[model samples]
Target: MLAIVSVTSPIFLLIALGFAAVRAGWIPREGALAMGRYALSFALPALLFNTLSQRPLDQIIVPAFLFAYVGGSLIAYALGLTAAAVARRTHPLDNAFFGMGVSMSNSGYLGYALISQILGAEALIAVAMSILTEVLLILPLTLILAELHDRRGRHGLARTLGKVVFQVVRNPIMLAIAAGLLFAALGWRLPALLGRTVDMLAGSAAAVALFAIGGTLAGQRLQHGLGPALAIAAGKLLIHPAAVLLMLFLVPAFDPTLTQAALILSGLPMVTIFPLLAQRYGLGELCASALLITTLLSFFTLNLGLWILGS
Candidate 1:
């Protein structure tokens, strides 16, 4: 229990401080968006490359963990959409936002911290996979859903595929993953100067991200759609983890390290990025509020999930 609090509290405290700063005008509101861009475009990708390139590909590609993480996300996304439709009277954009809020987690940030505390650095491969699943697989689908919601002129199936391809190509995390894989395949290592530089930048990612998340929470207000926001939070903290555990039986066993990693990753609350997506794409206030709610509730839910797994 102390381990949990020790790790989780510092991260949350930074977030809380960031939020208070934003509220008190100590930090400009615009700074959060810029920090977010740095996280998405540079820092996170550097971290992904450093982490994954160091892992043994054969051992890291655990089919069971993949199934649990990816399959659970798909199920949770669908359930969130269905719940939104039935309970919130939300429009397509709203539905997509709520679904994303529930299904997409802060896996890379929170997962790294929690798993490192309870598991260890050797579990880093599982954390890398968690990030890959969340950033690569789940994120694109959510973007497509948002596009579909906005009626962004689907030229054809091929065109839609092309756009997704373009988006993937443009995504820094995907690019880093691809580059890392290529280097790994060739048994290449980064030069010392470049590698150390990347290591330094990557190390700053979690702290900046947590601070930005808090700033985001400070900026959020439930200007509309409380019902959907609450529903999204419930889906994230409750249904998503439940889906993961339910699917765990169908999959093969991961190593204990990976198993613990998966549990912690799966139970993370909504990513701080969701609200940025909502605001950028015109999804609306409920989306951000949903994110805030899920993040705040995650302290309890993550502890419960870890206890269940450990027991």
Candidate 2:
């Protein structure tokens, strides 16, 4: 528990401090957005390429891990939607963001740090699992849900899915993952110079992204709608993990590492992308508030999981 706190608290504090500095005008907000774009477009792709290309195929290709992780995420989506219905949330975009807040996690930045600290370097494979599931699987579904719920016009659904496909195709990280997998399958390796270049950029992605995530949340409008945001946060940090554990129990895998990792990862705070996706799809307020609340509350839930697992 102490180890979990020791590792996660400092990272979040640094993020919070960055947000506070930005909010106070010590760091220009525009500059932070620029940093975020660089991280997403350049640094993150490099990181994904470096990580995926070098990781063992067995780790990345585990069927059981995929089943547990992806299944857990789907269950989270259903649970979030159900909870929103019970709460009488009728706004389509808000509910979509609410559902995203439940299923999506800060897998790359926050998950990597916490899992590595608690579970060692081996945990990177689990992070890889999360990235693959999130980027390839859950993200597309969220976009589809957003479109179906969109009532802007008759063509809104087409526009929503079209933009989603375009963005997915354009995503550097997704491209890197696809390229790296192909290379891995064909047993090809990048030149040492290119590999080193990737390493340099990849090293900077996590911390920068975390800081930007904090800055993004610092500017949120959490004051207006507390109930739905907390409801979403509860689903993300608490209910999601519980659902994953239940799934794991029902399946009863021979090895527990993947199951354990998936459950813990599911319990994490909403990803920084929540607000971005919400803004793009029109659920900015809900996404922003959920991001802030979950980020703050994850300390307790994460530590509790660590205590249970690490014990």
Candidate topping TM-score? 1
TM-score of each: 0.92, 0.91
Worst 10 residues of 2 by lDDT: 250-259
Per-residue lDDT over 1-311 for candidate 2, one digit per residue giving the tens place of the 0 to 100 score: 67667867877786887789799988887777777788878887776676667766665667777777778888888778777766775776556666678988888777776666666666567777788888877788777777777667434677768887897887787888787777777778888898788889988887887787777666777754888788888899988888777777666474566566787789999878787777766667767877888888887888887778878
Candidate 2, clashing residue pairs? none
Alpha-carbon shift of residue 303 in model 2 (angstroms): 1.6
Error of 1 at 220 (Å): 1.1
Q: What are the per-residue Cα lDDT tens digits for candidate 1 across 1-311?
A: 66667666887788788889899998887887677678768887887788777766675567888889888888998888877778767777667776787788786666665666678778877777777787777777777776666654534556656787798788787898888777766778999999999999898888887777777778888786776678788988888878887888788776877877776777788887776678866665767778777788887777766667666
Score residue 219 of candidate 1 by CA lDDT.
Answer: 83
At residue 224, what lDDT does model 1 achieve?
Answer: 67
Q: For residue 220, what is the lDDT in candidate 1?
A: 86
